[model samples]
Target: MNILDDLKLQYKLGGIALKMIYWNVACFLVSLVFFYSFKVGVFDFPSWIALSSEPAVFVLKPWTFLSYAFFHDGFLHLFFNMMVLNFSSYLFLTFFSSKQYLGLYILSAIFAGVIFVLGFNLMHYSGAIIGASAAIMAILVAVTTYSPLMNVRLLLVGNVKLWHVTAVILILDLMQFRLENSGGHISHLAGAFFGFVYIKLLQNGIDMSKILSIVLDFFTNIFKKPATPFKKVHKNYQKPAERPVSKIVVKDKKQQQIDEILDKISQSGYDSLSQEEKEFLFQAGK
Candidate 1:
């Protein structure tokens, strides 16, 4: 089979995280197509302008917060993000439900975008933040929270627990906070914090899925109508028919026999049973 067909098969069999990675990879390819077709001018579209300034120009442009996560500026940026997304998503889908998995992904992206905006505005960083590092950090934090002691065996590096891996990543982000791509690192930290906090809140029974539901309800209400009261239906009364005396008497006797049998079974173990008794017990439970 061709490589594209292989990827499609793998994607069909893969869990939620893998599917998301596939989606991000597809978006990256599409962005590349746009980049080359536009003579590499797409990458030069000021990240800050695309993310922050443009939204003010058009209210519908707020979706860039979520869309920007899938847009990478270069091949290296796309490759590392997809690698991290695939690994992290596999770990996430191993435990969480698909809905929870997606909720976390979107929430992480929004949190990352907010942090990126904050850094850009407050710190005056004109550079644009791209890639799935923030979302990957969120997944890492979530997996670590769920199974802190779960060992991940790395090639040549042997095994390490999830908590240690998260710690190292967090430390690296902290130490490199002032680097050229500091905004992206800050966004990663935000996503990581959100992942950890989200898991903790889940343990306490605060479902974040309800937030998505609320958003859905808001949009649905716009196009839907309110329910109207329905009048209750009434039926004409009719007389009942009578049963035969012999049939009624036989049914009462059978009920009494069944009750006695049940009482005997309650006093004795089911192992002390006759064929008739077994059938009676089975029918009674049913």
Candidate 2:
């Protein structure tokens, strides 16, 4: 298959993690087209699309809580986030179901977004945030929480514990907590925090992911198509001696010729037919 067809095939066959990556890539492409400003060298995401710190904006456009996680501001932002996402998804899916993975990704994003907005408002800061950093961190942290001692190998860093990788990321975010992009840092930490809470709750027999499933089922049922009723007909069985005799049918000269031509076509393909046979078959078809 060609490149595009191959990608389509992969998407169709891959699990939730690959589908999530595809979604992020698709959203990034969309943002590049409609939100990015070449002259300004930045994306100009609207309040409805990006999560705004302002209570008024987010409160009015509540969907931004989840929508913002799908968009990225630049190519590098999308690239690194996707790389981490692929890594985290691989590790997370190792010990969890696809449903749980999807639930954690979505729920953590909303949880982080809410905390980001609250933290920003408390600090009297006003800004917009876009990107899957928060959600990606949650996935990474969630799996790390579940399996802290799991071994992970890095190219330049050699082998290390999963928790070590998670800790380093959390530390980096904490170190830059007040340096730059404070909102981004806050959201990342918040996501990590949510991830820990999610695992804890799950361990305690409280699967918060069920909440998402319940809500989704509710909406799905609301829009679900009703099944059409089909009538069933029961056939009566009969003994061989008691069954009606089958009728014999005779084919006309033209039909006999057509059947011979069809059998020949089936055995040797349509191309094997002679010129007269082809013409006769064509005329018969008409």
Candidate 3:
């Protein structure tokens, strides 16, 4: 099929992380087109746009802090970020739910933006940061934290524990603190820290997904009518005669058999059952 169709297929089949990477790439492309067509400066792109004209070192725009992670200034920048995002996200989705993935992505972006801003302010760095490297770093950290002993194979390198990769990336970022793109490095570290914290919190059963759920429920309740009070409507309703002992016992026995069958289906594969059993399980699941 055509390229767009191929991409659509990939996105449909890929997990949440891949879909996120695709969104970032699409945003970068759109920003590039705007930059060229509208004569907007390349540095004015979403990722690294100047925060303030008067303050050269500040990068505090509300949207820039988060949106910057989705924009790239060059082909190489986009390529490496996408590669890391794809690989790390694959590992991440294999373990976490979609809500967890989305939460991590958003929090990672925010943490990265904050770190970038803080670093620029503290170190007097003047350049704006862009790209998803920080967010990808966060994903890498989360994957490694969740599955520390998991072995990952690089193209040229042999299989290595996931934590080793995490360690190396953190060290590299630490050593590169004085580089011109120090703000970006700091942001990556921030994202990595957030990922680590997120996993730790998750291990303790603290889910941030509830926050979004509550907000959605509030909005839904706002637009919906209140529940009506229950009314006791009484008519000359006569109680039915008691079921026969044998019939009642047989029906109860049948229900017990159905429950047992359903339990078995849940523990084993549906293919383990016959057609009649399959129908029974389907009806029960519904």
Candidate 4:
């Protein structure tokens, strides 16, 4: 197959984070070609797709809030965002479904874009923005908040707590707030806030992932399902024989406790689990 076919196949097989990173990289390449050949800046490629910080322009084209997260101005801007996104995706998918991750990423990006525009307008700042930084930040912070004590080994830092890494990143964002690209920093924090809140609400038994489920359902239902054919039967047709229910259906208390511990490991990492719980899971897996 040709390169295009190979790319399509790769995209089909990859998870949400890889798909997102691929899209951003593709957009960047397309934008570069157009910039060199057509004299259009990265953010000025087309009004309907690229995002602008100007309130008047944004009011006219609201979809840019979501679209803007797919393009980057420079290589480093794209590289760092994609790296964090890859790491965050591995950690996030350990506990959450891919659908939930897609929802959180989209929701966080939209919220960050809108907040950036509003904040920029209020401060009379005149600058355009485009990148996946906000969404990447959200994923990183969200996973960290859920499992703060998780241990991660670094090349030079040995093993550090998850919360420690998150705190360092947050501090850098805060420190850069007054130095340069303050609006970008604000958008990052907005995404971070959304991530933290999304997980907290989930722990309370309120799932926000349903928002993306609705969106997916709408798109998938674009072609309606064929209706069932009408059936005809005799007036006194007898019903089919019923099957007996199984004697053992639901799991007992021990099984239930084991399932809970397993879920906890998925969320907070195995190290956060007690020794007893770890041994139980190990034995059960065997």
Per-candidate Cα lDDT values, in order, are 0.73, 0.88, 0.73, 0.80
Error of 1 at 120 (Å): 2.4
What shift in Å separates residue 67 of candidate 4 from its native position after superposition?
0.5
Task: Provide the lDDT at 12 for model 4.
Answer: 53
Please tell me which predicted candidate would have the highest TM-score against the true structure.
2
lDDT for 2 (candidate 3): 45
Models sorted by TM-score, best on top: 2, 4, 1, 3
List ranges where model 2 is wrong by over 4 Å. Answer: 230-232, 238-286
lDDT of 1 at 219: 98
Model 4, 232-251: lDDT tens per residue?
A: 86687679787654533334
Worst 10 residues of 3 by lDDT: 50-59
lDDT tens digits, residues 198-248, model 1?
Answer: 899999999685687678779999989878989898988878677679988
TM values, all candidates = 0.68, 0.82, 0.68, 0.74
Q: Residue 223's C-alpha lDDT in candidate 1?
A: 87
Residues 1-286, model 3: lDDT tens digits: 3446445544654567768878888977876776544554443553344222224333235666666777777777888888888888889988888887777777788777776766676766555677788778888999898899999898899999989888988998898877647777878889999888888988999976566557668999999998999999989979998877998888798789777775775577434556565555444444
